[model samples]
Target chain A: MWKSVIYKEWLKTRWFLIIYAAIGVLAVGRIFLKVQHDFTFNEATNFWYVILFQGYQYFGILKFLPALGGLIIAVSQFFPETVNKRIKLTFHLPIVENKVMIIMMLFGACCLLLTFGVVSLFFYGLSIIYFPHEIIHGALVTMTPWFLAGLAIYFLAALIILEPVWKFRFLYALVAVAFIPSVFFDDTITGGYSPANPVLFVLVIIMSTALLFSGYRFRKGEM
Target chain B: MVRLSRYFLVIIAIIAFSVVIPKFYWMAFEKPVRSPFVMYSCVENDFMIQKSTQDGLVRTDTRGNNYTREQYEEKLPLMYMRQLMISGTMPDTINGVFMDAREINDERSTFRLRTRDLFTPDPGLYPMFESQSGRANLEMPDDYFRITWRMEFVDANTNKILEEKSRMFSAVLYNRGFDFPAKSINGIPTTRKSIDEGYLVIDSEDQLFHVKMIKGKPFVEKVEIPEGLKFKHISCVDFRNKRYYAYLFSEENDLYILTQDDYVLKKLPVDGLIPEEQEIKIYADYFHYNIISDGEGYMRSQILDADFNPVDEYSETWPVKMERTEGKIYKFLFPGELSLSNSNSNYNAFFLNLNKSINWLVLSLILIVIQFFIIKRRNEKFKNQIVDFTAILFTGIFGFLAVNIFPNKFFK
Candidate 1:
């Protein structure tokens, strides 16, 4: 059952994922090229000074890519099911209704995790070529919140789309939009998320469970 | 389970609303409010103020005498010493104290330390620069050190840990009674200046220590923090005068100057200064120094002679309109607020600050009664009304929005 569900989601989202990956690479590559150009055209040690002491964020160009990718994939995966009333057939399958919802959410999460992870790793690899460990480490920690926000928006967009009522969907959208500011709150501050990281992890867990509640209401036909 | 899920979703929605409504109100309605600038007049031994009024910009002394800009500058001779010197109007003596131009220029330097409530903690790593570089200009070092239970320097070029120098720094700190796993550490690594005063560290026991690299060696000193003095912020002051090592602010809003002398802490005479929200400016001359702190609704100034004696003090205040507006809204809408960040730390954590609750409680009661009538009109059971009422009581406006949006239905 999990295999079929995974395959079905893959078939729906493969093209979108590939396009997002290409865009992510291009965005990240542009930042790297800019840094290389700075090193070449400007004084050599100036790049080191900017990266180290100035708290420059080389990966800021890729900030919105992950969140955009997550939202697109979530909508693409679930909107068709709702439009054609195909979600009802899936709910009536040989399984507990909530498990099916949970499985679907997990599939979206895993794909997003892989997408965000690959992009972050590529950024890390590129950073170490010209920058030191501390610089790369600070940049990665600062970027983690943005990536987590991507996963959060994915689950939230899915919940809002699957929700059966307009008023309730608007409430979900309001809540989701309110959380958007927190993603970019400390993105400019180097290593700013060091203290709030534990709290952030907890927020991610809460967001994942929020989808279950939305799914429960849909299954029970609550207005 | 369905009911539980609804409650869960409602709670999340309320939290989100609590974060958004206040922000939206402020973004739309906030207006600029400026406090008067207060400066102490050394010659007159009185506080002077410059402020905007319905008439125009007014300059007045505390004794109620209005003065022109030139008169105000003449009253603060030492503060306006540079202007006077450049204009060839140098005073021979004022308030019985003669001033020398070169001496004033050489001795006069000011350093400011403002609090950043939402900054990153030290990553325990610092780039150790060579104090006496053989080259004329100081260059960035290739190695950085991390202080854990011990100090370990890693080569930035090769990324290899240097075990020997790491042991040397660890031993020196241990000899000065520095503990392992530091509670907080701060450093000044920008070597654009003439001298390097490496790092200020607070150990696990909250003891302060000064560590610097002198000629590629460790110079460790245990700073003497006053007994029972609880400080909340520390910053290194690399002034050309070299009079003070750093500026420390206590938890009780007292700003202390940590003099270069080993055991000296000069507490500045300023009152009710919120370091996080205030801007401090210090003007120094050979005869006197003027310290001005501007907070949200008020500005305070203190004048001190060369000996740090209080010559005069002055202040002016106006009502902060933003707080008043927020206060009015809190009465109508919310019982309290949930804050994600505080003045001391920028971490995303939950903190509940309650405003006056009686009005909000009354408002919530009225709202819930209206909701009860609506449910009753639909012939819903009394038990179903209980969830909606309790939610309103607990979450105020957010609960009202949630229940209206996700109303419970009963099929007759």
Candidate 2:
């Protein structure tokens, strides 16, 4: 049953995923190329000094892509189903209804993670080439919130689209926008998110479980 | 379950509006409110306030008497001694002390101290540099140390923990009677200057310690803090003068100078300060030290001899525009509005600052009445109407906006 759900999600998002992967590669590759150009053409010592002391952030361009991917994937997976009332068929399947919704959400979230992971690994290899391990670790830690925001928007987008009522959907989107952007409150180059990351990570995970409640409402035909 | 979802939505909306609406309002309307820089002039034995105004840059004494820019410079001869010397306008003497620009520049010391609110958390790690590397120039260390129960130096290059060096520093600090985990620590890297005076750390017991890495070894020394003096803030001073190590502020708002003697703490005779809320600037020369503490719209300055004895003092107040406007708006629109604010720190933890405004109540009443008419037109249940009214009454404009924008489906 889970395999079928995975196949359905893949069919929905496969083309978009290709574009997302290409954008991720291009963006990360561009940042590395720019840094390498600076090192080659500009003063290498000044470049390192700016990174170390002046808080030069190399991974800033990658911050919003994960969120965009999550949002698009969520729309692709559910917008068609809701438009044709095909979500009802998925909900009425032989498996537990909430279990199906959860599986679908997990599938979308996993895709987002895989996309972000590949981009991050590439970034890590590029970072160590120009900078030391400490800087690379700091850059990666700062990127955690951006990726978490991606996963959050995916669930939030799913929750919003699955609702049958316009009023409820608008309200859900409002709340989601407010909640999702708070993850980006600290956009500092180094150590901004370290203090609140653990607690915020937990809050985001708990907030994602709200998908089940929204799904339960859709299943009950509340609207 | 539908009712529960309604409540959840309302709660989320309230929290969202609490942060979002106020933030947008502030971004649109907020202005920077600043007090003028106040410096004590030992030559005139009065405070010279330098501020920029709509008319032009103004320099004034505490009595509202205006002075020209050159006169202001002449008044603070010690501060402007070098300029005065270069421009051939040197005053013969100030407070019976001979004015020499070279000596004044060499021996003059200035330090700044500031305190953050209690909610601001420290980064919990510090990078100690090699203070006495047996070379003329100071260098940055390759490792940074974290203090848990002990100091663990982690190599910045390889990201590996130096276990042996960690144990060695831990044993030395333990033997020096520093509590294992430091309650508070502040350090300034010596990379800015030729000479390096390492870090000053305050332990859990409120004791002070000087720690530095000297020639690939930990150099630890205990500084005797005055008994019963509860230190609240530490500002490490790395002045070229090298007369003092750092400035320490106590819980009672008293300022103390930690001298270069390594054991003696000089208690400066100045009072009536809130460190977190005030901007303090100390200007020192061979004969006199001028300490200026400026809070919002208020400036106080004191001149002291070399021994920290009060020589002269002055204070003044002025009308602050931005603060007054913010205060008035807050009173008029946000009465009884419970906002989840992370006021002092960057961390987004919820804290409440509750105040009642009759203006907010009136605005809320107006919004609720309009909402009541709409709900009546839609034939909403009495319970739903009451819920909307209460949300508006509590959150004022934000509730009105939220409910109108996202109408409750249960009403239909």
After the best TM-score superposition of candidate 2, give how far the Cα of residue A149 lies from its true spot, in angstroms: 2.2
Per-residue lDDT tens digits for candidate 2, residues A43-71, read: 45445545555667877798888889988
Mind giving the per-residue lDDT tens digits that candidate 1 earns over A1-223?
7678778888888888888888887888899899888877864455656666676777777777878987988997888777866787878878887777777878888888888878888888887787667777788777777787787788779888988888778877877787666433532467767666666666676667666666666666766
- Tens-place lDDT per residue, model 1, B182-207, is 66666567767667667777787778
Sequence-dependent TM-score of model 2: 0.82
Best by TM-score: 1
Tens digit of per-residue lDDT, candidate 2, span B322-364: 3478756866676443232344443334445555446678888
What's model 1's lDDT at B45? Answer: 71
Tell me the DockQ of each model, to 2 decimals. Answer: 0.37, 0.22
Pick out the ten consecutive residues of candidate 2 chain A with the lowest summed lDDT.
Answer: A183-192
